[model samples]
Target: MGEENMTKTTTKALMAAAAFSVAAPALAETELNFWSWRQEDIAGYEAIIAEFEKTHPDIHIVYTPHEAKAYNTILTTALAGGSGPDIIHTRAYGSLENISSAGYLEPLDGQVDLSLLSKDELLGTTLRSDGKVYAVPFASQTVVVYYNKDIFDAQGITPPETFEEFKAVAAHLKDAGITPLANGTADGWTIEVMSGAFMPNFYGSDFFGQVTSGATDFEDPRYVTALGKMAELAEFMPVGFEGVDYATMKALFTSGAAAMFVGGSWEINGFRDAGLNFDMMPGPSAEAGGERMVATWMDGGYAVNAASPNKEAALEFIRFTATTPFAQMLTDQLNNIPAVDGAVSSDPMLQKVASFHSAATPYIMLVAFRFNKPTGSTLLQTGLQELMTGAKDAATVAKDISDGIKNAE
Candidate 1:
């Protein structure tokens, strides 16, 4: 061949090589976005994602953590704009209902193997709604009574079992010049549990169910009794509780300024890691001298965005989170329970927290998911806060909660 012809052939070969490289399967990588509430959650998630990426080299994930306060609002705005992450964590039953109803979350029942997972691993009520599952159970944190063992021993007081004993202890502590209970009433949700969980024990487990189902009136005697008990408890709590928040309240407990505190199991790890000497027991029951059982609520779970472009990948992520090292990490490292079955804690404090849940008899109260709407609990929270401040009487607070539910309907 001539010199010019040879040069043209070399150029053509170089162009074909570049085209082949561009068209290769190695270049076809799938990317998905995930949004979550906790910044700390990202580190664990990233560790999982790193393993996942190694297994599936073609998939790349982008994870973003949002501050808890900004989480739902940001997700709402993104969903409205038709742009958001492929996966997100949401509140348990009621929240799942709202997001699913709004067409923002995909039904995850058939996509994941629910039967293989243990019923105990999940918040049981969350797994089904009318016999159909909507989201994958992720992390669960249950509320429990946190007591300073040193204080209880020093005061010669045992942790309260029944409501009457609880009152006696509070009185004893008060007389001893120690606040029997240290709580942060500034958080509206804290106050709601006092009225919604602690007091409702007098009415039985089905009390809230009846109210939610509209079978009972809001002005019923049961609700009034519960509200009254809440006010009574408030009178015995430490002063300046209204100005406190969870962090401050936790600090007080860790610093040994308070004898007893009520919070979720999530705080156990923090307290343990802080080297605080504390013991946990169930909250007081309504029946005098009855078994030490109390109302409880679910904390966290994973849900897939209905509008996600990478639905399959998101479902896989949910499955992973509900299983193995990720599941164990939630309980082991973060001091939270896994939504999967057979999850146990190696940490002694977490082990106690789990034992309390296992020993719960008759029923584990569903205090949080009282309404289907997202704002239902908030309304309850607001009413409880007003009641605590004496701005609203117990009857009016009860009426307001009932009225708010009616309006939500």
Candidate 2:
């Protein structure tokens, strides 16, 4: 062939090589499945997953979120079957026991540096019997009274310091044709939340330590007094509150028809999204000049399934979740108190909520008493519901809890 014809053939060969390169099958990437019950946070998890994949081109993560109510059953069933996702979004405290104790979770202790968390923070993920940590603590939830600033300003009310004053404030709100407290006994868990959020202020700060240490039981006079204080709140709740559900109760507050709501920090994002002007406070002290305390708990965490095929990749992702950047991302995206101590959020409401943490106590039933069957949490919820409905008085309810689960640990 002539020199010009040879040059043309070489160019054709080069173009063909480039096209083949573009069309060739891509290298197989390790696929990791991360399962959680946060179905609403798919976008937030997607952002985190994208960031992880950016530096880890060889690993791909799929976030699978189940319905929150059904998640525990689904996860336990899958794990028991000797098959589950690579990364599991496990609940904290006693909720982690069944999975970890059953050998379904990969013990995360030395594999992931949970050193960023303090010993107290790590308690949420540590197995009680073995002392083996199974997951990275993800977030901390604080329970407080959320008040609508717009209504409070209009009603000329400041946060009431004493239980009597709080009741008076509620009465004032009611007289103005507004629902003073947006709560109902219809939802069992919300009742437990209210009891957690407000009872410490009534029982005094020392009761939690005493009850949890075996020095006292739920039937102690102090606890009965606290339950009595919680029952007093029934009179201040929205009219016909007995029939209202959690969603309707929240709507009553968000729509400005109610003045205050006793709820958790997890409600922050939803309140903000509704454009409601609000602030939160630890509940009123039992008496004037008494110390006020808030209730807090470790929400949940991420763990690796012991049977996962992509264990290394799952560990990489779990380690990433333990980092400050990921914590910050989670805080910014979800407005949560990310469990990492190094992670900080500039959100004004979160900052205020954090301020309340200075005097916070562990959410009583969950942190101290959820490890066994007929958990204190179950008893508290049922007792509180009965107390709220007048079907049981404070003393009876307290005795019921003490009889049911005080010695569970």
Candidate 3:
């Protein structure tokens, strides 16, 4: 052969070798079908998976993001039918009540390294029972008061620090021709915030701890007092709040139509993205200058499917997700504050919210976590709605909630 022909043949051989080297791992990689409730910024998730893939060259990820509203129902149906993702993200309450009882989740106590997380950092009570952590907590969210800076400044109302001051502020806002609170009571969960989140403030820590433990009945004096306060405050809220939905109420605050909104930290991104400047202050105190034990709850975490055919691969996938940078990516890029300590936040709004969460003492509230008895979410919603609509008195509402717990238990 000519000298040029031999050189070309050697170059072709090198190219072929490189191609096979890349294809070999690509063909060898084990695949995991990972599913989530929403597309919810898959780019962030993908970044984590990419990093995991680099480490485990023999593993691959199949990402499937589902519709947020239908994910739970669909996941349950699929699990029953024997076909689902290798790993799934689900709500804490749903996981404990629905998935755990169904035997769909593998107990993760010894499987994942729980010692890396702090007891105070995780949603302390929500993620653990019997001294074993079933789920790896991913995020802790608390209900807080988001207020329009312009409105508060214009009305000369410093954010209310006490229940009495809260009432006066609301009245002042009303007199100033602005709705005091941008509450959307039409949704059931909003009612839950008032009953489950806000009411505990009125009852104080000890009373709430008793009710949560099922030691004191839900109809205790503190419970009634909280309901009465919610009823009284409802009158000062916007007149058309009954017709509002979550998005609408969020818009009301964002657009400056309403003075304040009380909700969880999940909406921080939306508020930030709207480019509307606002300040998140403590919720109006239930007592005069008393410490507010914010109602913070565990959002969700990684759990291996008990019946997954690819159990080892599923576990590898979860281990990678839990321990690796991808786990941090879930919070960092996606704007969630992960249960992992030192999970940094780039968004100033998230940092602000985290500051509030860090400032809260007594750590997790028992009522928020539904600790011992697991407060009936449906019953709590109904009771609060009745109070807001003037359909039930404070004492009657408390009794109904108490009875609802008994029936469930």
Candidate 4:
């Protein structure tokens, strides 16, 4: 009860409280590493991360963006070496399957709540054979033919509804001294997007599944016909078309040098900023009465690494992606179709793109079909290039693709 004893006890208690306060911050802080191939998406993702950090002050996100061409190889190397990022941006379908089969991905089944997303947003293509989810689908994209409205209006050409009409339009544009289609085969992957836009019209939705299941192969008469059609279309492109790269192709279309660009919905913002009046249409059907189909699929999204040192923090970030704010930011800023349900954008081009979903089919070779190590896309690209150069016939190109698939297996 003495005054000196009471003063000493109070000072000791205050010192202990100060020590605990200093240690509390250290215990609460957590950092998560996120890896993605989209450098263009950095601003949108950073905005989302900043918002996420507001509610989760203890968590810090280290965003690392890689070049698209080198991302897969680099990510595979890192994962195989057992030192990959905590969060990974993964492509859907075969790419997901390839990584999941290697046991590099954490199954999101019970760890993350995706119920906020609709069934369509769950991306059935990313589901494993056992029905477990390995990733959260973030966006959906469709391969479309983006035509310059000014160019079309100048020539009085309406968008074609049938393959015959498409051919006629191309001829008309060519006769007008305008390049009909802007494509860059030099990048190799552009052929996949180009083929995705056209091949489904010839073979239908079931064709890709049949090829994967061995019910039909690439050497079929239909595939040869598709190759022939591609070659015929190529004739409308500029001379030495293979020399054109992606930038060149985009320039040709946006600068009004070319009448149309064959690409995905992701290019809308770039085209809009280029001051070109443009619109999109679903890929035309092969026959006059054939179905009009658009090549649509779930694009890449985020997944957790099974070997991550910060698994819980990674899961928390992934769960946050399903929230309304994140989805809205994706739509408003990136102009992408968010994978979350009820996430709508006021962008007119996006609205027009979504209008074609009723006629959409899974992107044939990209999502529905499982490509082996070398990929059917690569083979088809090389074959089409050879055909363009007159070094290979449609039948021979088809046979080479069939044999490549078989050999890869």
| Backbone atom clashes (below 3 Å) for every candidate | 2, 0, 1, 0
Q: Which rank order by TM-score, best down to worst?
A: 2, 4, 3, 1
After TM-score superposition, the amount by which residue 268's alpha carbon in candidate 4 deviates from its true location, in angstroms, is 0.9
Tens-digit per-residue lDDT, 228-258, candidate 1: 6777777676687788776777777888887
Q: Write the per-residue lDDT of candidate 3 for residues 224-281, one digit (tens) a residue.
A: 8888888887877678667777778877888998888888777776787788778887
Residue clash pairs of candidate 2? none
Q: Which stretches of candidate 1 lie over 4 Å from their true place?
A: 1-31, 39-54, 57-63, 117-132, 195-197, 322-326, 358-374
Candidate 2 Cα lDDT to native: 0.84
Name the candidate that leads on lDDT: 2
Candidate 3: list runs displaced more than 4 Å. Answer: 1-27, 38-43, 57-69, 119-133, 324-327, 344-348, 358-375
lDDT (tens digit, per residue) of candidate 2 on 170-272:
9999889988999887877788888876788877778889988889988888889999988888988877777877889889999998889899888888888
Residue 206 of model 3 has an lDDT of 81
Cα lDDT of all candidates, in order?
0.66, 0.84, 0.68, 0.80
TM-score of 2: 0.90
lDDT of 4 at 350: 90
Instruction: Superpose all Cα atoms of candidate 1 onto the true structure and report the RMSD in Å to 1 decimal.
Output: 13.6
**Which candidate order results from sorting by lDDT in descending order?**
2, 4, 3, 1
Error of model 1, residue 367, in angstroms: 6.3
Candidate 3 contains a number of clashing pairs equal to 1
